[model samples]
Target: MNETQSILLASACFALAFILASLLEYWLHRLMHVSKKVGARHLEHHRNNTGQGVLWEFRDYIRGAIVLIAAMFFYSWVAGIGWLLGSLAYAAFSAYAHQLQHENPTKCFWMKMPVHYVHHKYGMWHHNFGLAVDWWDKVFGTYKLVDWLTEEELSQPEKNLLQLRWW
Candidate 1:
């Protein structure tokens, strides 16, 4: 293929990779709750957010890193560099969004993320599994909009990303 054609192909693959990654995150997040072993480890993340420091969720971070590295290798082999790069982008975004969820950002942008916010708000381990988007959840009947929750109910968690401390 010519350079231009290759770039185009890679771009297409990147888009596909992003969609796949989002779907993958939804399934994996759901699995983490359903599977005993996965849920046990993931519980640490819940506990850490309750009162402990954010850094205490080191295992979650490490697991995400290992999975992303493996995914990049596999996606590159299957779809080429563009797909791999796209997967990397999804991985980074997923990490940031997850942290923001745990940090309990109050800003409109952070608060608007339906999936992660619902997951934390209700402590609903089985629902709202999407990371970057809610398409899959909506399709699968797992999406739970938090708009119904009263402001008082939402106050338990960090109100906004601005609450995050650098120290």
Candidate 2:
């Protein structure tokens, strides 16, 4: 292929990788809400503004590493260095954006503000499942705009959407 063709192909591959990874994250987030055991741990995440504790964080890191390595290998074979690098960038950005969205939503730039804020503040567990982007939530009819809840209200013992049977 010519150099221009190669670059276009690589760009397409990169875009595809990012879209696929985001979709996977969307589903995983939804699953965490559906399963009781998963929801319990995630509940702690909502209760504590910081994040999941060290052990769970470590587990997530391990999982991310495995996925990243596999993506690197696959994309390298399929679309050369350009796509592999793009996938790596996508993974890193997704991780950083998610952590920021949880730890301090105000500081996050790429994701829509207060979408995650509303998620945590209202325990709207099923609404905003998309981490790095809101496309899936929008596509799946789960996106909703919510005003901020008071701290006292946020602390109330409410039904988590994740704990629901049809979430």
Candidate 3:
């Protein structure tokens, strides 16, 4: 094909890859909950460690690094630089969001940690499943970011969510 045709094809590929990546993220995010055998550990991860304390619960950072690297290598192949950049952005955003979820932010106009705080209420395991963006949660019929606490838990001085306690 000619140079123009090649560029157009690449652009199309990028757009398609972007949409596919988004869809894949949504599916994978849900899978992390639904597939007990595969993501049971990750699911327990939330139950065990809510918020920033999660990063410390992993006994082996090497295993986590290996998983991340493999994912990056696989994604960078067909998705190209744009998607790769998005992957990086998503990782950073997820980490920040996780941090924000634990403790309220002073001014969180960007990550909106307070939006996630509601999920910290009691019996909220099935809600706010998205790690990076709320789009997937909203689409997958589990976008209840608001608090789902019992009257008893809400009445307590400190909400006692079933979360991982790193303290």
Best by TM-score: 1
Q: What digit string (tens of lDDT, one per residue) describes model 1 on residues 8-114?
A: 87888888877887787788778888888877866775656532233433334446655654555564453567776777777656665666555554442633554
Question: Candidate 3's residue-wise lDDT over 38-116, tens digit each?
Answer: 6777666567645545344222222433344245445444334444445444444455555555543322345333434
| Best-matching candidate per lDDT | 1
Candidate 2 vs candidate 3: the TM-score winner is 2
Query: Quick one: ranking by TM-score, best first?
Result: 1, 2, 3
Residue lDDT tens for model 2, 32-143: 8899876687667777855443344434734755555365556445474555556566665565555555545554455454455567666786798766677888889988
- lDDT against the true structure, each candidate: 0.64, 0.62, 0.50
What local lDDT does model 2 show for residue 68?
57
Displacement of residue 98 (Cα, Å) in model 1 is 0.9
Ranking by lDDT: 1, 2, 3
TM-score for each candidate, following the candidate numbering: 0.71, 0.67, 0.52
TM-score of 1: 0.71
Worst 10 residues of 2 by lDDT: 158-167
